[model samples]
Target: MKWEHALKDYKLYLKIERGLSNNSITSYGLDVEKLIGYLEDKHISVSPLNISKETIQQYIYELAKTVNVRTQSRMISGLRSFFNYLIFEDYRVDNPLELIESPKIGRKLPDTLSLDDINRLIAAIDLSKAEGERNRAMLETLYSCGLRVSELTNLKISDLFFDEGFIKVTGKGDKQRFVPIVQSTQKYITCYKNEVRNHLSIQKGHEDTLFLNRRGKQLTRAMIFTIIKQLAVKINLDKTISPHTFRHSFATHLLENGADLRTIQLMLGHESITTTEIYVHVDKSHLKSVLQTFHPRK
Candidate 1:
């Protein structure tokens, strides 16, 4: 089968069978695309099934010269998954990546903002501008809901069950979950909706999207990252903060204050409890206290 045809099938499998989101599917596709690009550059036209282990190893070695260890690991993992899918589909009798080794890299925890730092960052926003109210509301929603940047950007006005204290979040792979929205977040969102977003000339197709640009278009992921960067600079915060940083901070603060891991996992829209366990590193003392207090034998 042609590589393009195989790629299309793999993407469909990831979406329908694995239930992955567009961004994730694109990421996996890009990983394979990287290998394709390398093959083309080297004048090697091997099909996916024809690729050898030596070729994979050489590509990884070349990748290590230009990419970070974490990215190298991710790329290797993505290729391995694609090959595994080929085996499952019976396109290949053996996987070339079955013996490929990923680079050893330690897990780096995400940066967390303390409550005071968060307040300071919010306080630094110049609320006199037209987008000020909207910015404030966005930041509040980020921390309060512990939303992934994509989740916040795609959030819908219809999803806000404010009267019932929850907002529906469509997370990775379009999985839906209801996260409790505190009164503080609700109040800011309401303020933006009534005062700012209501007055904008919303573009077509983004009417229900809760956050919009001045032109009424849904805010792009890059725009969100830029907003956080500007705020971090204004506040003179030492850490390099992004939209995701707020999410990490949200989970970290919650864990520090005694929120359960399972609850945080649900709020963060993590597929597994282990994914949520990273926040546990923020407070060793708190985890110990919870263990000592809740254990029946303790």
Candidate 2:
């Protein structure tokens, strides 16, 4: 089959069978597209069904020279999944990337903000502007609920269950979960809703969306990043951070405050307890306190 045809089918498999998000399917598709580009550049005519391992290895060798190990590793994984899909469809006998090994990179721990740092960042918001209250509410919900940026952007007014103190979040793969919301966060969100959002000439589709831009539509993910980055600059903070940083801080702070892994896992909507265990490594002081409090020698 042609490379384009194979890629289209692969993306469909990712969406329908694997239930990956659109962003995830796009990323996976790009991996195959990169290979197609490489073959075209070299004048090598090989289809996805018949591409040899040597060709893929050569592509990786060239790729390693241009990208870091982590990026290279991710691309390799994406390509591997594509080939595996071909095998599942009975189009291929084996994956070209089967024997390829990813580089041995150490686990990169997530960066977290201290409570004081968080406070300073929030305090730096220009409350005179209408968006200031919205920004404050967004950040509070991010930390309080440990939501992914997409979840925050896609959040709807109907998702807020303030009477039960929880907000329904739609996470990766369109999975939904109920995460508890603190009263303070609820109050901030309510204020933004009753004041700023209520005044917006909201677009028809985004009327249920919790956060709206000045254009009265759902806020984009980039806008959220820009808001946090601008706040970091206003505070003169040194760390490079993104919206995900607030999520890391949320998990780390909970662990430090004696919340167990299982509970944090549920709150974060992690499919695996192993994914939540990373926070255990984030706070060494918490580990030390655990040992000191429970160890027989102590």
Candidate 3:
């Protein structure tokens, strides 16, 4: 089959069967497109069904030269999954990447902000601008609940349950979870909603959206990143930060302040404790504090 046709089918399977997010499907599709480009570059006429393992390995070898070891590992994994999909569909006898080994890469720790850093960022918002309150609310929600950028942008007014002190979060793959919302976060969101969002001429489809741009539509992930970057610049902070940094800070701070990993995992909507365990490597002092406070021998 043609590379284009195979990729289309694979994307469909990922969305429908695997329930991957659009961003994830696009990422996996990009890996397949890269292989197709390599084939075209060399004037190789092999189709996805007929591609050899050696040719796949050659593509991977070339990819390694362009990307870092961690990115190369991820590329290898995405390509492998695409071929495995072909096998699952009975279109191929075996995956071309079956024998290909990914590069060994160490786990990189996530960057997090200290409480003082967060305060400085929040304080730097220019309250004179109409978007200032909205930005403050957005950042507070992100840090308070450890929300993914998409989750923060897609947050709906209907999701807020202040009476119960929880906000319903729709996470990756549309998985829903109830995360407890502190009164402070609730106050900020409510202030923005009442004082700012309520004054906007909201677009029809975005009526339920909690955060909107000046155009009255939902915010984009890139816009959220831009807002944070501008704030970092305003404060002259010296660390590369993103919307995810607030999330990492949320988890790390929770772990540091005596919250257990399982609780953080649930609050962060992590499907497994293993994914949440990365915070343990962020600060050894937290571990020492836990041992001292809880261990009977102490």
* Residue 296 error, candidate 1, Å: 8.7
Task: State the lDDT of candidate 1 residue by residue for 1-298, as single tens digits.
Answer: 7778889999999999999999999999999989889999999989998889999899988999999999999999999999999999998988887898888998788988989999998998889997889899999999999999999999999999999999999999899999999998899999999999989998889999999999899999999999889988988899988989899988888888888899999889887999898878767888798889999999
Q: What's the lDDT of the predicted structure labeled candidate 3?
A: 0.94
lDDT of 3 by residue, 1-298 (tens): 8999999999999999999889899999998898889999999999989999989888888888899999899989999999999999999999988888899989899998999999999999988988999999999999999999999999999999999999999998889999999999999999999999999999999999999999999999999999999999999999999999999999999888889999999999899999999999997899888889899999
- Which is better, 1 or 3, measured by TM-score? 3
After superposition, which runs of candidate 2 have C-alpha atoms over 4 Å from their true positions? none
Output the better candidate (1/3) by lDDT.
3
Q: What's the ranking of the predictions by TM-score, best on top?
A: 2, 3, 1
- Ranking of all predicted structures according to lDDT, beginning with the best and ending with the worst: 2, 3, 1
Worst 10 residues of 3 by lDDT: 56-65
Q: Give residue 67's lDDT in candidate 1 (0 to 100).
A: 95
Q: Which candidate do you rate higher for lDDT, 1 or 2?
A: 2
Clash count list over all predictions: 0, 0, 0
- How big is the positional error of residue 129 in model 2, measured in Å on the Cα after superposition? 0.8
